[model samples]
Every structure is written in structure tokens, then in C-alpha cells.
Target: MPLQTVLVTGANRGLGLEFVRQYREAGWHVIATSRPLDEGVRARDCGAELLQLDVRDEGAIHALAHALEGRKIDLLINNAGYHPGAHQLGELDYSSWQTAFHINVIAPLQIAEAFLPVIPPGGKIVNIGSRQGSMACNREGGRYLYRATKAALHSITRSLAIDLTKRGIIVVALHPGWVKTDMGTDSADIEVEESVSGMREVIADLGQHNTGHLINYDGAVIPW
Candidate 1:
């Protein structure tokens, strides 16, 4: 296959940055978008196009859509996320919940919709997801907003799979495992490199049979 073009949101740091680095190293033309381009140099050095994007902004997303007109994206990683401290169930802030919805859920769907025409057959969409959002895996209840948002993401992935199937684009949700990124913290079992490598493995292994699935970084199926 020829070189793939990929876009990863939140590419300035953490798993997003690692994804940009690994994909670029693997010879993919990467469009790495982050809110602040000043912090995007590392991704740029890795052969990525550092793009200005705030997923919360519809205008920015639309602008990107226009800029990429005539371009075909082989893979799109909806990796940007936010977890506010006001995530406790009983003490939840309605504002934080809204913010979570905007970034963690709405943005992914909007991006997919805005760029739908550019994702050709055999293209892939990997929604960076979490086991924390899994109702089957939920052991605690404090992170209400974050959990709800990610669970919604899982739903979005499945729905997109159905909608994009006719177009021959494969859409699946991926749990990155507990990797040590800025979001995962130091105690997180896997390293950023390890998680990205694992996700790449999973992506490379995906086929028609795997579309609409919720999988871990190791390619294990995660219950809905």
C-alpha cells in the first residue's frame, strides 16, 4: 500500500503525540492537530503537519475540512479528550458535563461527519476510548462525566461503523489500556510507546470482521 495519511487530535501531548510520532516514523503522512501550535514542535519534528485545531470549535473543524479538501485520509484518530476534576457523581458540575460532551463525544462525531467524503474505502477510524466507560467494567462511580462521555464515544463508534460501512470505512473504538501518558499518570502500567505500538498492531490487524467492535490495545474485545 502507498503511504497513509492520518490525523490525530490533541497531538501536542500524551498518547496523541505518541501516535503522531509512531505513525510518522512508519512513513505515514500525519496531520497532527492541537490547540496550541507553539507546543506542537515535537510532533512537527517527527514529520507531521502541526495543525491548529480546537475540537470544541465547529469553525475550526470546518476550516480543517476545507483545507483538506481533495485529500484522502487513510486513518483518523479521535484522540483528544478532557477529564475535569469536577467529575464526582454527587458533586457533579453541569458545566463540566457539558464540556465533556463537547470534547469527548461531540467533536469526534463532528469530525467524522465533516470529513466523511474524504475517507475512502478501506480507511479506518480509531476512537481512543476507555475501559472506565465500560458499564461491564465499571467498579467505581466517581467519574460520572468522564465515564458517560467515553461510553457515549463507544456508542458513536458503533454507529459510525454502521453509517460508514457502505462507504467501506472501518470504524472501531479502542481502549489504550492504562498507559503512562500525561492523562494516564506515572503509575500507569504501560509506557506511551508501548500503548501506541499496541494500538498500531491492532489497527494493522483490523479487517471487515472487526468493524464496529470495541477493542483494547491488545486487540481483545471489550464488552459494550
Candidate 2:
């Protein structure tokens, strides 16, 4: 049988890079996307087919989809995110907030839309959402831009799950936790390996019934 193919966005470093490494190690065909040309090469070094993509660019997404038309995509992971500006209630840059929304929210949905035609039945889509996104789970709230955009991602995740159900596609929002990445920072609770491993397990077990759920890396269901 042919290896299952997974397409991951922003796969140059951090969680995205780890996803590529894990999947490749597990004998899957990985298609990794990054913005920089050197980063693309790094993805290639990690045993993935590299595609240069800036999630913010809709035309590039469409072009990639067109280029990969007829190819089977077993999984799509939208793992890119941008956290901008101060989280303080009123001390935010409006422009940075717009950028955060564009990168964190709109881009993932656009990428999903572009690739929908080629994803085979039983294909899965995992949006790398944040626990901060959960309105029900937000206790300390303040990271306005990041939080709002991730919340929007969860909303989109639910919609995609419902809309794609008839076609046998599973869509779910995944929170990787406060991982030790640049975004997560050095003070985070868990390492990249632990988080990615847990998420990989979650991905492996996903089915139609799991669609639309907000799942933590450790397989716990988070309130939406």
C-alpha cells in the first residue's frame, strides 16, 4: 500500500517541524510548507516534499492546490499561527491585531478551502487551535488578538466538520498546549516531543465521530 500523505503548513520549525519529523519517521509521505526558501530546504532535509507557501497569500494557496490536483491528501494540518501585540486590554496595536487575524484565522480556512477538492474520503484536517480560543475555557483572558483568532478557528473547525461530514472528511480543532516552542517560549510546561506525540496519537485515532471536537494533545476533550 502507498504511504499516507500529510500536508503541513508552516513546517519549518517548532511544532510544525516536529509534525513532519514524526510523520516521516512513521513512514508517511509528508508535504511540508514554509514561507522561506531556506526553510523549504530544511523541510526537504527532514524527508518531506517542500512547498513554499505563505498562508496569508490566497493566490499561492490556490496555485498549490492546482499543482497538486488529483493527488491524494490523507491529512492536512494547519499549524501556522501569528501572535502579535500586547495582550493588555487596551494596549494593543490595531495593525498587529489585523495581522494576527489574517495569519491565525483567515489563512487556515483559505488553505482548507483551496485543498478541499483533492482530499480523499476519510481524510483528516487538524487546525492547530489554542486552549485560549475556548470561550468556555478562557479564565485569565487578555491575549486579545491571539485568543480571538483562535476562537474563530474553533468556530471554523466546527463548520468545516459539519460541511465535510457527508463527504467523509473529519475536521477537528487541536490544542497542543503550552509547548516549549518559540511561540510557547522556554517557560512552557511541556516539550515539543511530548505535545506532538500526543497529538499524533489523537490524529491516528480520529474518525467521523471525532470530528468537530476540540481536543487537547493528551486526548482530553476541551470545551468549545
Provide backbone clash counts, one per model: 0, 0
lDDT measured at residue 163 in model 2 versus the true structure, 0 to 100: 98
Query: Could you tell me the lDDT of residue 7 within candidate 1?
Result: 93
lDDT of 1 by residue, 1-224 (tens): 78889999999999999999999889899999989999988999898999999999999999999999999999999999987777665777887778889999999999999988788899999999899889998877678888889999999999999988888899999999998877788999999998899999999999878999889998899998
lDDT of 1: 0.91
Per-model TM-score versus the true fold: 0.97, 0.98
Q: Which stretches of candidate 1 lie over 4 Å from their true place?
A: none
Predicted candidate 2 versus true structure: per-residue lDDT over 141-198, tens digit per residue = 6888888999999999999999999999999999998999989999999999999999
Q: Give the worst 10-residue stretch by lDDT in candidate 2.
A: 37-46
